[model samples]
Target: METTNEFERYQKAKKQVEDIKGFYGHLASYVLVMGLLIFINLRYTPQYLWFVWSMLGWGIGLFFHAMKVFNWFPFFNKEWEEKKIKQYMEEEKKTNKFE
Candidate 1:
């Protein structure tokens, strides 16, 4: 049981590290792509300045991704939601009722 618990902890840590790494990778890509887009927009069509659209669109997605990856979202999260569900299920079982 102890070993199993340790393995679970290790797995969770590994998953979290992967998520952080993935977010950094996304950030890097966003930087590179947006830089290119800005350069193009400035060079070819400075009057139109269309890169802002892409910037805002992808930025909103990046913000949400950061929120989820870093747990900045205060409302809830998958792990907390699952734990709550399990807790409520156990409580329902104890009461011999569910709603």
Candidate 2:
């Protein structure tokens, strides 16, 4: 019984991690597509050195997307999601206790 409970916890944690990653990926995709459009516009216009800004924006947004997808960036490691979910659960427990 104890082992089953532990397994369930692990599964739940893993699922939460995937869910967070999926959510981040979806949002990042939207940002990336917009950045791509900005890049294209800058390339075409080349009026006021906007290309640099577009590239920077695209790079930063893509970098985060890569980090979330790969779970290898220094600040956003795989463990981050686990910690976040655990923290959320802890907060929920406290909130529930008060209510």
Best by TM-score: 1
* Ten residues in sequence with the least summed lDDT for candidate 1: 90-99
* RMSD (Å) per prediction: 2.6, 7.8
| Superposition error at 52 for model 2 (Å) | 21
Which parts of model 2 have CA positions greater than 4 angstroms off?
40-99
Question: Whose lDDT is greatest here?
Answer: 1
- Per-residue lDDT, model 2, residue 80, is 79
TM-score for every candidate vs. truth?
0.84, 0.39
lDDT of 1: 0.94
lDDT digits (tens) for residues 1-99 of candidate 1: 999999999998899899999999999999999999999999999999999999999999999999989999765897789989999999889888643
Please, what are the lDDT tens digits per residue for candidate 2 over residues 3-33? 9999999997897689677867767776777
lDDT of 2: 0.74
